[model samples]
Target: MRPKIYLFGDSITEMSFEHGGWGASLVNHFNRTVDVVLRGYSGYNTRWGLKVLDKVFAGSSESESVLAVTVFFGANDASVEDRCSAFQHVPIEEYKQNLHSIVSFLKGRWPTTEVILISPPPIDEPTRLLCPFTENKSGLPERTNEAAGNYAKACLAVAAECGVSAIDLWTRMQQIPGWQTACLSDGLHLTQTGNKIVFEEVVEALKKKGFSLETLPVDLPVIFDIDPNDPLKSFQGI
Candidate 1:
């Protein structure tokens, strides 16, 4: 069976196969070596993600072939509880618990499958104020970097506890000079450059786990490997 990379996260993950998305970038990078599967849901938090975990993995039990799974919920979980988007607000503690549940579940099911936890990217507060999640007359953003930082930290803690890998997107993105505008499109979503950062980071993390594109075994031959005299010969038994 072919090796697979599962991306389980929120809207940012859901749209990862778009033209310049990070998921698509992975697909491009891996080519025929490994398949990148998308199980992303829009506007989901760790709470909802936890509830649906079984539904996504129950039908697929090919544990050995499962290379890695990225758990990337939290942007929605960081929502302000008293705000209009409070429906998605999960307390920081609960968020950590939910993340722990997710990592534990994946590792339990796929014993060798690497679980990479990606914290939500930094929020662009001023832009969010101008374009709130909903029409909040309070003139406030539903999410903020400070609020999301708690969840991001919680994510890193969970990874450390679980002894797995993690990407501290919130902190990493903010470290850039103009990250507020450079990384996020509005307040939450990622721009092309932002997606590029995510793609690069994932590649680096996977490389550390010994899963680089150069190291992964290729499934089929490239065009150059196909013999001009007998093109079908290469694929007959593959």
Candidate 2:
């Protein structure tokens, strides 16, 4: 059976297959070797995400192996309760617990599936203010770098406790000079450069776990190798 990689997260993940997006980059990198499954739900937090995990993941076949599963969320969960977008707000403690639950559940379901938790990226409050989503006057941006950092730390902690890999995007993005201007298009969403960062980091993490795209067998014979006279030869070992 073909190997699969699952991307599960919020809007950042939902839009990951767009032009110059991370998910699309992975699809290109893996090519015919693996299947990239997108299970992103825009505007959904860990609270809602946890509830729908079963619906989204359902069941896996014994013959089907999942190479990796990326759990990316916490952007909307970091929403300030008192801010305009309180609907997406999830308490920090609850957010951490939910992440633990998610990792545990996925591990239980897919014993061999590698889990990679990605922390939400930093928020640019000033740039976010310009977004129509935060039009009305409010105390602070619906989300803040500080608040998202807190969630990012919690996410990392959960990953450690759950024995899973993690990508600390919050801290990494900030380390990049002029990240505020280059990494994010608006205040929260990733720019093309930011998506490249994610794609590279994820690839690095998978490599560390011994998942090398170069080592995987091609899913089928190359089109150029398929002889028109004997097309069945192309599918012989597939």
Candidate 3:
């Protein structure tokens, strides 16, 4: 079977296959070399993600070739505890523990599979108000950039504890000028350029691990290698 890279996260991940999305671009980058699977749950926090962890990997085989699995929760978990969106909030400490548990589970289930942790992007409180993706009758932003940064930091800590790779998207985007407007669409989700950033980062992570479009073997011969005179012969030993 083809090796797989699983993307697990919230809405940002759930919608990552949309046009100009990072997941779609990742597929294009990998071409036929690997399979990229999406297991994103919109509006979910680490708590909910932990609850469904078993079901997500229920049918997996111990020996199956899973190249990597990315844990990218925390946006909802970062919701302010006193806000209308608090229903989805998981305490920062609990969030860390849950993320740790997730990485442990994936490592235990597939010892060779690389685990990557992606921090939640920062919130644009002002734009979130105008966009109104959530039910916010409180007349205040349900999430804040500072809160999101804490979660992002927690995610990085967990990655360090687990000795795995991580992408600090929260901090990375903020480093660039106008990133608040340039990267996000609804102050939480990604724009096309934002998706490009993620795709490039994920690619860099994989490349760091000695895996890349050029390094990983393609699943089958390229069309150029197919012999019209004896097409079936090329597939005999595959």
Q: Cα RMSD (Å) between model 2 and the true structure? A: 2.2
On TM-score, the candidate that comes out on top is 3
lDDT of 1 by residue, 1-238 (tens): 5799999999999989877999999999998898899999999999999999999787678545899999998999999999878999999999999999998899888889989999999888889887776778877788887989988989999999999999999988988888888878887899888899899999999999999868888888789999999999989977
Candidate 3: residue 8 lDDT (0-100): 91
lDDT, model 1, position 181: 80
The lDDT leader among the candidates is: 2
* Model 1, residue pairs in steric clash: none
Task: For each candidate, give its TM-score against the true structure.
Answer: 0.94, 0.92, 0.94
Expressed as tens digits, the lDDT of each residue in 19-126 for candidate 2 is: 999999999998888899999999999999999988888755545788899999999999989888889999999999999999988888788889999999999999
Error of 3 at 30 (Å): 1.2
Counting clashing residue pairs in each candidate, in order, gives 0, 0, 0
Error of 1 at 72 (Å): 0.2
What lDDT does the true structure give each of the candidates? 0.90, 0.91, 0.90
Candidate 1 lDDT: 0.90
Which lDDT tens digits does candidate 3 get at residues 1-238?
A: 5899999999989999988999999888897888999998999999999999999888777888999998889999999999878899999999999999999899998988889899999889998887765678888998899999999999999999989999999988887688878999889999988888888889998889989978898888888999999999889988
